[model samples]
Target: MSLHESVLCSTLPSQGTGTLTLHDLQTGTPLALFKHTSSSSRCVAVIPTRAGLGGVAIAAQVDKAVLNVYSFQKDQVLLKCVLPERLACTAVDKRGLLCAGGTAQGRIYLWEKLASGALCNVWDAHYRQVTTLAFSHDGDALVSGSDDAGISVWSVSRLLDGDAQNTPVPLLNFSDHTLPITDVVVGIGRFPSCRLVSASVDCSVKLWDFSTNTLLTTFLLPRPISHVVFDATERLIFAVANGPEGDIYQVNLLRRRDDHVEAVGGAGVNDIIRLGMENKNEQDPASGKISVGEEVTVLSLSLTSSLLLAGTVAGFVHVYDVHSHQRLRSISVGAKITNVYAMLRPPDLFGHTSLVAREGSIPVRPIAPLQRTRATEWEGKEVGVLLAPFGKETAESLINYPSDELQRDFALLLHTSPSNVREEPATATNARVAELEAEISHLRGQLGRAKGVNDAMWEAMVRKVVAQEKEKNNADEGRIKKKGKKDH
Candidate 1:
């Protein structure tokens, strides 16, 4: 697939009734669009691995009480883990370990893929439903946020060392939420310097400097934060919340302007208190400028924080350019997109949650456009949406056709073969391939004249590839004809 096509979303059709569809952010095309076969999926996580750079998303089924894992590489379920009951939530570490929190019960189970290609690690922790889980950058700690409004940080190595019958003590239990804690994260950096951030239903995001075992900052949001993430630079804390109007906020933690330190610890000035700094409207001591409207509900932050992505029940994923504070783009997932997740790969990754994949390009041919209904007349009932991945052009076209229309389109696509080599004289095919390769070589030279990957470069690359493939086909046909003559 061309870089453009690779970014487009492609749907995988399934006969199941309980399907969950994911549209690719690049092409706005359906990527592995499917529903749960047995029941509604309770939780899903994307995992990226070397097996393929793409992600493998795991879905927990409430009715089946089993976890289904799939990679974009294949349609079949890669693995399944039977659970004691329905899982409320799940998280995948960078290394591909899968963990789930029980729904009705308050236990957390750790799962690992065994050498035999089966899932292992069946156990539980916590006294209640675990709503959120995050693995530290080092893979040493696993933190979970729960309905209890308490955040617990656990030692992954220690958990693995425990016997099947032994219970473990939590490294730290930061229980201070008046309401439920919705999300938790361990800051990135060297060991012994890790920090933790927690979002609460109480409308605040708390930063805990774990080294000091104290709360670093108490950030009150414009609305109750549904999610929180560190920006690409890790200096800015991003958050998402619910309000009458949809908005996202960024919190700058490095500014010493909020430097009023009141000790909250016992017996001495042991703990630092940076109060009155909660609201950004306060005057900054450094620049002496009063800031306003700095708080935002963070929906999702890119892995590196180069971009801040947020979504609200209002059905839009707002992409902020970060440093510029400029609105880069807004992606409309259409149906009230309840959750907006950032996978290393495109949102349509079917297999693992991560985005790294090596081989195989799932070609998705566009379907015919459907008519707009009265309700969708606002957007012209167009089957396609423009994606703002970087440079602004209608780079991708999403085909959200009706089921009947999709069937017809799928059949039509099957007839269009990828242009490569052609069926003709071997010498002629070889010459065509050489010419196309030479053209691609020349295009590489022209790249030095441009500043970025512009449309011209993309067009040239696509044309070159198509030509090469056609030439390859022709050479294969020539070889077959030669064999036929020998038989004669």
Candidate 2:
């Protein structure tokens, strides 16, 4: 039996069609989903304010021109704001301030929240279509990468332009990347202060030391990149790419004493369902004794990197030993898996929520564009679907099913499959990789100019743009209403 056979499964309402489902990983249940009502909800980010601060936020893009905000309670749509026409990307600060990008325009929108919990201001600070957005750990600033081949930083406090002698404050724009930036993430552990890592369509993941606003290192990917993320504790960085064939890779980033960089292949190129942190290995400093623990991918991993918890695209969430890459046990959500959202709950429980699995529909952006008629049919299927695997309840659900005996037999067979191991590629090729690294450097240098503007000036420009757009939308609505009245 395969791993799928041993796991129990259940279906969630194919959530709202076209929505991104974020499950509470700690409880192993669906928490909230950010759905695209008109266009598409590209990304969903949940930033938890300090514990007991009583605020957690979720932000998602809608129609490429608007971002919707929902509190953790999943109640009340907190904010809705229009942005540039084509919002290709979005990200949020720890305090729930939002940053978003547009295509062709290379502009980044900086959204701030008022003390009264309302959206305070919006600014257009970039000169090109922004592709990726990241925020400092402290939420004091935001980082934006654009197709214009530049990464720009905006100070959140600078929203109050008068503080700097009543002069308009300019955003710190860093011009790099010959190609469009695909993804950006703040540093996890050792490189903590305002450090960030960004991956580009140029097939490179570059680390930036924000304190200096300069590139620290550039790492290569096996193919054109798709998405990138950091491990729970930030000890590891993972990137995925689209290949001619169906292949994916999970690589680890490491720094060498010679100032050279290496992209060690830590996980193999199978269609990676989800990349997350697992298993934290803690060691005693005095005796150098190592304590091995469960390999669970939790929202936060331990200092030793021994415990990790992550859900998969296969509808199963596993808590396993990272060193051994062994599945301690797995829970299968009945639906094909999408994304996993992990949360921490009570003392013994850790939530591992799985998103709607990717099946039937192809990823929105394929490397090679197919003709309209040749695209996969996504019309009939329900959207926003997810599977949540319960712990004992999952086991019991299977055991009590009408076909309990068949389920038990299937479980036994899974216990016997060739171990269902996950393999990693070797890291032996560094020289040729470095040569390619040089090519990547050349690309980053060949990008165009990215202009910066004063925060106040940009804010005023955006407010005017938003007001005009709102009026146009209202006028269109009025015309539609008049037509309906006439027909009636």
Candidate 3:
């Protein structure tokens, strides 16, 4: 049996009890729900188990700290475990062998899975309130970030291999950020060595070379980063920032530049309203305008890296096309979204399809570029006929499906094979080729600029290190002279 793509969202209660809801990401339908007896849930972590099974660990606040672990086979929960701890955050290793939880008081506890579906062998790891934790690709290392602005990389093997008498030390300690660290993720790419990335509340993101324990580069964003998810290729970072009017940015990892893609908050209400009016006449009275001061609180990226899901404080989940940056759909969940996790189906579940299948396919003559004309001229007019044989009722039926189903069909259409789509005119094909060439040229220039910046930063670091070494030598000479005078 193959697993299906799903999304797990933890809700923060506005006036009632909190709950964890799971939905099929492809269709946006509720799959399962687990009600929490507590008032609020803080963080969640997913652990991938054998035979395609998985488990979710949630930290909820009650009279005492509690960690609720739910084991799942596919879309249903199989088992649950309630542990004692006021965990601020949690992380699990790739193999689900190790689980780590960060506490509100800055302590880290590690747990090992047992055969009885329980987590055991708990141990302390961090001294300060840990904000985020992530396992390395190989599962041999664990990286943690804390409110103290310190990052520690621990040797998972050593930590697990040691006995109760011995404690393990961190392999590297990074303390460069001035503010609290919000998120930390281990990098995955075609790089020669291991890399780690950290986002801080100080409005900066730092990339580190784990092998050398050196900071590789830093990127400054417009606002403090609230959440971040890397693309499948790890070449792009999709991030949501903290503010009343939250904005989403696509940051090129290699070029180190931020591109504002979409505005999900109340600042873009006018644009959204205009779009709604253009799409429909006499908008539904029940669909009121998005209020001012709504903030996007959570973000998740689909496995294909083709869709982005953003959840707001106003109980709305907006999905956007990663390539076009267009809003695809907005869903109401009826509660503030505290966490959003996108789970991908196993590769065996679906046939292999090219992500850019339509890149060279049918560029059906751009609908005359949509000239600005009077609405009365086109209203209720059949300006064009469908190329394929389709009845009016069939077209209306396709359009009348629920929004989630329509969105799923749209995604499927994007993934259709190139051979299935109609071919474009020669003139249009040549124009598209030219556009691609220009884009490639622009990217090359950006790559060169990025390299130049990296080189300059490396030189500056060398100079600073040399100055420090010279100062240390002078101090040593002064101490030697003082010793000689004392001897005389």
Candidate 4:
């Protein structure tokens, strides 16, 4: 009972099927429709089952190597999961715990129990095609983005706990875009402190701090951005500009510019805010010449109606007004929009559809079973006698401290107290026993990067089912050698 109204999710990339819509930005309507769900370009994900209303998990869209989770207390699109790569994008974790995916061969799965579809870490984050993953409003870092122009970050508790002496790498990789990564966003701060903002098809955007990997700023825009949102007081960004008169820039991270006109990677140069699109006398902040056609892609941003949604490859979405640059409505959903999602849509996912559920809503929890299970293993018995005797007590003693006193002693060892308390507080039971010894060192680095992403995704689904059973026994020995050369 919280998460009241304001929706507009979307997704598209049609190759023959797609639809994940939710729209209703003050009367253009479309409230719910999951449709056949093929969606891949800008692969989807909604997640919110606890950051607001108490239900929603939507991953919506994907086919090769399946996937289809859609829950809001379920109706018809039961959960699906069958992966072995082929995902391409989807990141959740706004309080809905975790769920990520990005592949097409550049791994990064992480799932921390999405209803037991287990597996919680897998890496090899990018050499090509990861294209965006974000998650850091306290989901403990993770920031991806690839196609090879790079941008790493990770550290979801060092990927569930990595070991071999804490080897989980990537607390920032960056690479300074030589033209790939397209959108990132991430900062609503919290967790090693945030601030990311990416975007780049080379027309730059940069900005970073990703908890001290530091870069800070860069904007150089004009076109080639194709999707980038952040406004709801994250100090305005709202990009999009991709082609055929696409326009829609706006950068303003609150001014700061020694006259920016060129400043590649030594990052620093800001002030951009001029996103008033639709040919308002063609205001040229370097010829963005507003029009909203030929491409645009996607942009969301409605933090409870500061509205700025923008989607289009020519199927419309428009709606601006981020402080009166005005346009307020366009809607169209006719196809081409790749991912919009302005957020907060939990009326129990509009009650139901095609299978009925409405009445008082809230019930669905179905998830585990779209194939590829095999992850069990977590023995217990208090993990063999609540122990702690690991070789030589990790001797690396040589401290000088002061990374702000090690982030204030790691925010006072992750403080915790009022949990609807009536009695809990010996310093919240020693911060819940130091969060159960960091969940037993994230289940001992989840058996190593969550069993190396579920045993290399079941060893790539058993080598794609044994190469389709040796291509069906070499087409049955080439049709019995064409029937022994047609019986000679």
lDDT of 3 at 255: 36
Evaluated against the true structure, the overall lDDT of model 3 is: 0.61
Number of backbone collisions per candidate, in order?
A: 58, 40, 2, 0
List candidate 1 segments past 4 Å from native: 1-32, 37-42, 51-54, 62-64, 75-80, 98-102, 114-124, 256-298, 344-488
lDDT of each: 0.54, 0.45, 0.61, 0.64
TM-score winner, 1 or 4:
1
Worst 10 residues of 1 by lDDT: 367-376
TM-score of each: 0.57, 0.48, 0.60, 0.30
**lDDT, candidate 2, at 197:** 66
Task: List the candidates ranked by TM-score, beginning with the highest.
Answer: 3, 1, 2, 4
Task: Give the per-residue Cα lDDT of candidate 3 at 39.
Answer: 25
In candidate 3 the C-alpha lDDT for residue 367 amounts to 14
Answer with 1 or 3, whichever has the higher lDDT. 3
Candidate 4, pairs of clashing residues: none
Highest TM-score: which candidate? 3
| Best prediction by lDDT | 4
User: Could you tell me how far off, in angstroms, the CA of residue 24 lies in candidate 4 after the best superposition?
Assistant: 4.2
RMSD of each: 23.2, 31.9, 27.4, 29.4
